[model samples]
Target chain A: MKLVCSKANLLNGVQIVSKAVPSKTTMSILECILVDTTNGEIKLTANDMELGIETTIEGQIVEKGIIALDAKIFLEIVRKLPDSDITIETDASFKTVITCEKAKFTIIGKSGEDFSYLPAVERDDSIVISQFTLKELVRQTIFSISDNDNNKLMTGELFDINGDEFKIVSLDGHRISIRKIQMKNSYAPKKVVVPGKTLNEVSKILPGDADSDVTISFTEKHIVFEFDKTVVVSRLIEGEYFKIDQMLSSDYETKVKVNKKEFLSCIDRATLLVKEGDKKPIIVNITDNGMELKINSALGSMNEEIDIQKQGKDLMIGFNPKFLIDALRVIDDEEVDLYMVNPKAPCFIKNVEESYIYLILPVNFTTVA
Target chain B: MKLVCSKANLLNGVQIVSKAVPSKTTMSILECILVDTTNGEIKLTANDMELGIETTIEGQIVEKGIIALDAKIFLEIVRKLPDSDITIETDASFKTVITCEKAKFTIIGKSGEDFSYLPAVERDDSIVISQFTLKELVRQTIFSISDNDNNKLMTGELFDINGDEFKIVSLDGHRISIRKIQMKNSYAPKKVVVPGKTLNEVSKILPGDADSDVTISFTEKHIVFEFDKTVVVSRLIEGEYFKIDQMLSSDYETKVKVNKKEFLSCIDRATLLVKEGDKKPIIVNITDNGMELKINSALGSMNEEIDIQKQGKDLMIGFNPKFLIDALRVIDDEEVDLYMVNPKAPCFIKNVEESYIYLILPVNFTTVA
Candidate 1:
């Protein structure tokens, strides 16, 4: 294969596909990216069995052929090359020669036939969605997904699609986050669990300011997303996701509104006293004067009281400070409301005027003095 | 101890002394900072058996006493507290109470008597030098210090003071870096070795914009540096330092002057082909046309030729790219001259007009094919 392309264009294309290449794989071919030169474009494809990425860029093609080269080495070379046109050609023995300015690289290429082909999705089964909405949805719910490999089902975000609105839910049993985004139009209703790793990769590659739409499709075991010049496919986890809606509490006796930034900083300071091996529980006590946050551990004890605009009955609850901090950071409002049902029951945190809700299970701190 | 001080002042004082506190020490008192409130000032001190640091800050002293608290916890609390007056007091049972606005912390403290006393340096034997000059001397040669504990002399920078000029040299067998700074006043000549770790801590606490002078004293087994509000003492490393000047060649048959940034970037790009387990050697071949750099490993191979204004015989030398990069980065010049005695000998690298010199030994390579 022979082609000539701009350094910037080639670097961007290589970066998108390099993310899908496995760093350490048992199969040697999985570490290589398949490069094909055709009519007026060059296509790059990389996959690691579980995830696959393909991207195409405009280039001048001198010949039509295909070769597989080491993904990381190729990307680094292209990124460092001077800003000029890069020429690549494959010899009869499949040894690829890349030239840019005075630099020349001779990389041994493998047979492209050994690379696993990415499965194609039917055009009729795809659904159209704005890139902005999809990006926001993934950012809001992806962080709450479980990272444990043993619980495979909980490691992915659950997407429930119905009519013109969709709900995304993620939970690790201790904490759960749910967000709903309104879609442009109604389509065939469906439900699928997308792995957190795949969604994270898609978010990074998506363009920020482009108004163009994205197409998404899913089968029984796989899901595919296609943008302007890139396609990403990931395997779905096969199991039932937790019933997050049932775990959310329905009623609360006290509701307090506090500034998000102030509340977040307070919780962060309180966590400093929570030892790593000990149960990192921060006790939140609300009284007529204000709210007091305290953390007691073998290391030391820390407490802070912030003035609040409330006169509710005195109540104290304990929770993992890290969970509360994480949930509070995701809320995009100046003021957030904390809904409490009882001292030991789960508490709901959300924006004062929005439908978004985050539930965190309280920790049992009776054993600690 | 009872005192009230500005949050910013307390934070700065804690940060400087905290660097001397050992994270893991056999004696628990070594992990705490001794706070003594007397004569309208609070003194903070920390030591790790080999190095000691003490700083004093002005405060409103309500009571004169002494206590030792965990350095890490105290620093964290000071960093997060609001920008206001912070009140600190020690109870009769040695529990330190720190209050800032509405926040409170009850940290467990130990008796100040348990802390080790810092050594005192005689004022008449000290040499005065600008803080800026000392900071510059440390940065230029510290990177060449050996990290191996077995070679105690090579793990520290040799400081040679004579009259009004100060010279610092460091070597790690393969490479050597030397820097010299001229002082204004004359003092007794002295020679001592300062551990790299102590210099690193001193660098962190030095103010970037301070123009004040620092007093430095060297004894038989210890070195002391005193500034406006802080004093640092470090134990000296013993043993004779190797004569690194003999390693540099006097005559060069071939030389080339090139842009420092351009050469650094080219070497960085060439090193990408080096694999982890491989020898990781990059070859530099200089000819009339230019200099060609190449690296061949199990991962891949890369070659780049940079144009230079030279007409010399072709020469090929291999060296670890990281060592060359580190040497090149420390030279404070736009263009650097490289002198080579032969293909296998150590090469001398220096600025065209500066007195600083860097020597890098070449790696032996077996040519294949």
Candidate 2:
């Protein structure tokens, strides 16, 4: 295989596919990216069994052939080469040579047949959404996904689509985050649980501007997102997702509106006093005058009072400060409304717009005053 | 103790002393910073047995007393507080209370008497030097200090002072870096080995562009640095430093002068082709035409030719690209000269002014054709 392409174009293309390549895998061929040169273009494909990424770039194809080269090494070499036309060629023995300016790289390549075949999306049902909106939705809910293996279903974000509106929910028992976005185009209703790791890669590769639309397709086993000349396919978790909506409280006896930035900063300061090994819970006391947050641990104890628009009697609750900070950081609102039915019940956090809601279960602090 | 000080001033003072506080120490008092409020100044001191740092700041001292509080917690609280007057007080039971605006913190404090006593420096043996020059000298030589525990003597920089000239040398067997600076004032000749950790703390805490001079004093067991309102004392590492001058070769058969920026950039690019676990070494071959750098690893191989002003016979040398880049970065001169005697011998790198010199040993290549 022989082809000539711009250094920047080649670097971007290889970077997108290399993200799906596992750094250390049992199968040696899985670390290589399959490069195909045909019909005036070069296609790069990489997969880690569960997820796969493929990207294509315009290039001058002198010969049509395929070779598999180390994804990370190839990407790094292409990225460092000075901006110029890079010439890539593969010999009959599958030794790939990349040359640009005064720099040349010779990588031992495996046969393309050695690489596992990536599955293609066969579902006719596809949804088109703005790249920026989809990226934002993923970022908002992905952080709450469980990192533990005990609850396999909680390790992925649940996506529920209805008409033009799409909602993503993520929870880890202690805290839950839900985000909603309005899609420009409508499609058949579908539900799938995308792994948090896959969504993370998508957010990084997806462009910011809405200049292009992301086409999403899903089957029973896998879901795929195609955009910006790249495709990301991820396997769906095979288990029944928890009913996150049911965990949210329906009624609240006390409510308060607080500035998001001020609240976030206060919680961050309070977390400094929370011990790591022990339960790092911060007490939130809502009174008629204002709201006070306090944390006590071996390190020290801190108390901060923030002015708030409170409605109802005074109440106090204890929860993890990190959870509240994470939820507040992802919310796209200037002010957030916090609701609590009682001191022992779960607290609901939502922006004034009421588009997204976050529920955090309070820690039992009955022994502590 | 009771005092009120500006948030910015308190934060800066706490951060400087916290650098000396041990993170995980067997002695609990070593992790705390002793705070003393008297008259109109607040003093903060922290020590890790070997090194100690103390600083005083002007504040409104209402009551004169002393207390010791956890260094990490105090710094975090001060950093998060808004820019305002912070009020700190100690109760009869030795509990420290800190209040800033609407934020309050209560930390368990030990008696100031429990803190380690910092040694006093004799002012008669102190010499003053420009902060900028000292900082530059430390930056150039510190990277070469040995990190291995087996060689205790090589784990520090040898500071040799004669009259108004001061030279610092550091080496870890494979590489050596030396920096020399001329001070405005003359002082008695002194030789001391200052631990790398101490120099690192001094570099981080010392303010740049401050016209105030830094006083340096050394004794048989300790070295002390005093500036403005801060003083740092560190224990000396006793042993004979390596004879760095003898390591310099008398004659070099080949030499090359290249732009510092261009050379550094080329070395950085070559490093990308090096793998982590494998013996990833880049070989530099100097010919009458130009210089070619090549590296081959499990991932791939890269070869790049850069134009340079060269003389004498052609020579090839293999060295770690990362070490080459690090040494080149310290040279302040626009152009750097590379001196080599043979492919297997160490290479000498120095600037045109010859104020600093770096020697990097060549790596043995397994596949040299």
Candidate 3:
């Protein structure tokens, strides 16, 4: 394979596909990135059995061929190359030569036939969604997914699509985060559980602007996301996601509207006394005029008060500060409403118009004093 | 202690002293920062046995008292507090109360008497120097300090003061780096070995600009640095430094002058083909017009050439790329001269006016082919 490409274009293509390259794998071929110059385009592909990525770069091709090179070394070489045109050529014996300006590198390459290709799926059932909205959905909900591998289902987020609305939900027993967005056009109903790792990688590579759209297709075992000259295919977790709707309720004895920034700051301060091994909880007391947050530990105690507009009965509750901080950080609104059924039930942070809700389970406390 | 200070001032003071706070120490009191409001000044002090730091913060003293609080918790509380005047008060029992704006914290504190005090060093043998130059001297030679603990003397840099010049030297058995600067005034000659860790911390806290000066005093067992509103006292490493001057020679068969940046980039690229376990050396071939750098490994080979002005005989030599890269990265000169004695002896990178020299031993290579 012989190709001449700009350093910037080649670097971008290699980085995008390298996300799928396994750092350590049982098969040595999985650690290599397959470089192919075919169909008048240069493509770099990497597959780690569970995830695969392929990205194309615009280049001048002298000949069409295929070869696989160690992803780590290849990436370093490309990144360190001077900002000029880079010529990469490989012979039938898989001897790859890369040269740029005064620098030249000759590295041994493996046959591309041993590398696995991304599994192709039918595109008839694909759905096109705004890349911006898709990235936001993952960023808002992915943090709630369980990191513990004991419950494999909890380690993935459920993508539920029906008609023109798409709902993404993630829960880790302690909290549940759900983001719902409306698609421009209607589509068939479908449900798929995507591994948290795949969603994270997709979010990183997705375009930041809303001008572009990402086409997503899901099969029985795999889900594919294609955007910006790049395609990502990941294995879907085979299990039924928990029914999260049953755990959410609109009924509440107390409702308070507070500034999100102020509330986050108060809780963050209260957590200062909470040590690493200490399972201390922050207590929230909502009154008609304002709210009081307090945390007491063997080391010390903290109390902070922020004015708020409240309705319904006065309530007191305790919760893990990290869960509240996590939900509040992703919220982009100025004012947020907190709905509490009682001190024993979960507290829901809701934005009715945005169709977003974060439910944080309260810690049972005997007394505030 | 009772005092009222701006949140920013308190945070700065805590951060400065917290560097000496040991993460885990046999004496638990060493983990706490001592806060004292005596003589109408708010002082924060922390000692980790090997090093001690004390800094004063501007504040209004409501009453005179003293207490020791957990350094980590105190710093966090001050950092998260609103940017307003903070009120900190401690009772006779050492229970501390810190209040800022609408936030209030009551943390457990120990008696100030339990905190170790900074060792007092006589100022008779003190030397005044620009903080900026001291920081630069540390940065230029600290990387060459031995990370291995086998030779404790090599883990520190020798500070040789003679007449009106200050020279710092560090060697790690593989290479020797020396940085020398002229002091404004002459003084009695003194030599001391400062631990690399102490130099690193001093560099971090020193002001970047040359507006301020640091007063350094050395005692039999300890060294003290006083600057700005802070004081740092550290234990000195005791041992005789190696005679590095004998290892350097002026005789050479080849001398080459090349652009520092170009040489560094070429060496960096050649290192890409070198594996973790592979002790591959980059061979430098110097000619009258240009220089060629080559690296060969089982994986592949890399060759790069950069134009240079050469004097003396043409020569070929091999050396570890890392040692060369480290010295070149710290050099500030645009054009650097290299003096080599055959392919077996050490090579010297020197700037006579700057009083900076780096001597790197050559790696024996059988053939360049």
Candidate 4:
């Protein structure tokens, strides 16, 4: 097998697929990237049993064959090579030789037949959406996915589609984040739970240009993402996601409208009183004047105030600062409306259009000297 | 005590002195930064026995008093405060109040009397040099200082002051690095060993302006650096440094002049053949045509060739790639001359001016298939 590719394209292709190559595994073959030209295309594929990635680079394939090279070593070699055409040739014994300009590298390769390829998923039910919308949806809601393993379903996010409106929801018991967007075309309704890890990897590889689009196709057990000449197949989590509809109610007795940037900065400053790993909650008091945030930890006590427009009763509540900060940071609105029932109830940050909603449960407030 | 200071100035002063505050210490006072205003200046001081730093910030002192606050908390609070005037006041009971704009923080403080202050150093013998020169000298040679504690003397760099010529030498048994610069004013001949840790901190705090000057004073046991309203006192290493003058010889059987950037990048690329913590040596073969570099490791083998102007007989030598990279990265020259004797002898990279010299020991090379 022989192929010649530009250094930039080859590096980008390897980096996109190398993310799925397991660093340490009982099966060493999972550490290699298969370079296959049997289909007349220079395709690089890597799979770690759960998540798999395949990317095709712009190259000239002189011979139609296949070989597998160590992903890490290949990545390093390509990274350091000069910005020119790199020629890779493999002999019958799987001795791979790579040359670029005046530099040459020789390494042992494995038979392509021994490599694991991505499981094929039927593409008839693909849901097309702009890459920018998909990236924003994942970024806005993926953070609320639970990181613990006690609840298997909580580690993945629920993607529910109804006609042209697609909604993504992620919850970790303490908070629930939802982002809803409209697709250009209507499609069949479907629901699937995707692991947070896969969404994170897809988000990184997906371009943020609004003009480009990504087609997402899924089956009962596998989901496929096709974007920018690359395909990602991920094993879907098998279970029913938590029903958060009852917990996501927008009923409230107190409402306030505040500037997003000012409110975010106030909470951020209050967080400085607590150290890492500390779960100290920040207390918020809403009145006719403004919104006041306070926090007391072993290190110190902080108080911050910001002007807000209030439309209901005055109230005080306590919440984990990080939960609010996470939601506020991804919000693009200049002013956000916060709805709360009482001190012990959940607070919702949402708009009238229901484009994005973040609900956070309050912790018990205890004033300290 | 009460003082008003700009948020920027206070943050900078705290950050500069907080480097001396011990993160983990049995004495709690060592974790605090002493704010002293008795001398009509807002000075922040932190001492960890081995090193001490004190810097004065531009602030209006309303009252004269002293107090010590937790360094970590103080630094974080100042960092998040708005860019405006910040007023800090301490009561008799050591209750500190910090306020800026609409943000306020209250924290507990300890008595300033309990804080450890910097040890007194004689200021009679002093050496003045441009901050840029000192910074450059340290950056060029500090990489060769031994990190192992087994050899205490090797962990420090020797500062040999002879009239106007100031030479700094660092060696880690495998290689030696020497950087010499001429000072604007001649000083009394003196020799001392400064711990690498102290020099690293000093280098970070020192500005890189060629116009600014730093006054360095040393006694039998202590070294004091005063610059830009800041004073850093460190305990000098008590021992004799390694004798590397004999190894820094100019005699050679083969000489080659190559582009510093090209040679550095080639060695850097060859480094990709070995993983981190692997002591792989790159073999260099020089002849009338050019220079050839080769490396073989468990992963693969790489070969690179570069054009060069040779002046002596052909030679093949092997040396640690990192040692060569360190020197080549710091040298500011278009072309660097390399002197080699044989495969087992040391290789010298120096110029006729003798302003800088780097001597690297050769490693045994075995031909690999």
**Which is the winner by DockQ between candidate 1 and candidate 3?**
3
C-alpha lDDT score of every prediction, in listed order: 0.84, 0.86, 0.91, 0.92
Number of the top lDDT candidate: 4
Clashing pairs in 2: none
Off-target runs (Cα >4 Å) in candidate 2 are A238-250, A367-369, B210-212, B277-281
Number of the candidate with higher TM-score, 2 or 4: 4
Candidate 1 error regions (>4 Å): A210-212, A311-313, A352-354, A367-369, B311-314, B352-354
Record all residue pairs in model 1 with backbone atoms less than 3 Å apart, i.e. clashing: none
Off by over 4 Å in 4: none
lDDT of 2 by residue, A77-112 (tens): 888888999999999898888999888888888998
- Candidate 3 lDDT at B31 equals 91
The segments of candidate 3 whose C-alpha lies over 4 angstroms from its true place after superposition are B275-278
Better of 3 and 4 by TM-score: 4
- Native-to-model Cα distance after best TM-score fit, residue B212 in candidate 4, in Å: 1.1
Which 10-residue span in candidate 1 chain A carries the lowest summed lDDT? Answer: A306-315
How big is the positional error of residue A261 in model 4, measured in Å on the Cα after superposition? 1.9
Overlapping backbone residue pairs in candidate 1 total 0
- Tens-digit lDDT track of model 1 for A77-104: 8988889999999987888889988778
In the order shown, what is each candidate's alpha-carbon RMSD?
Answer: 2.3, 2.4, 2.1, 1.6
Which model is ahead, 1 or 2, in terms of lDDT?
A: 2
| Per-residue lDDT of model 1, residues B96-197, tens digit only | 889988888888899998889788755567787778777877887888899998789989999888898777889898888878767888777887889999
Q: Against the true structure, what is each candidate's TM-score?
A: 0.95, 0.94, 0.96, 0.97
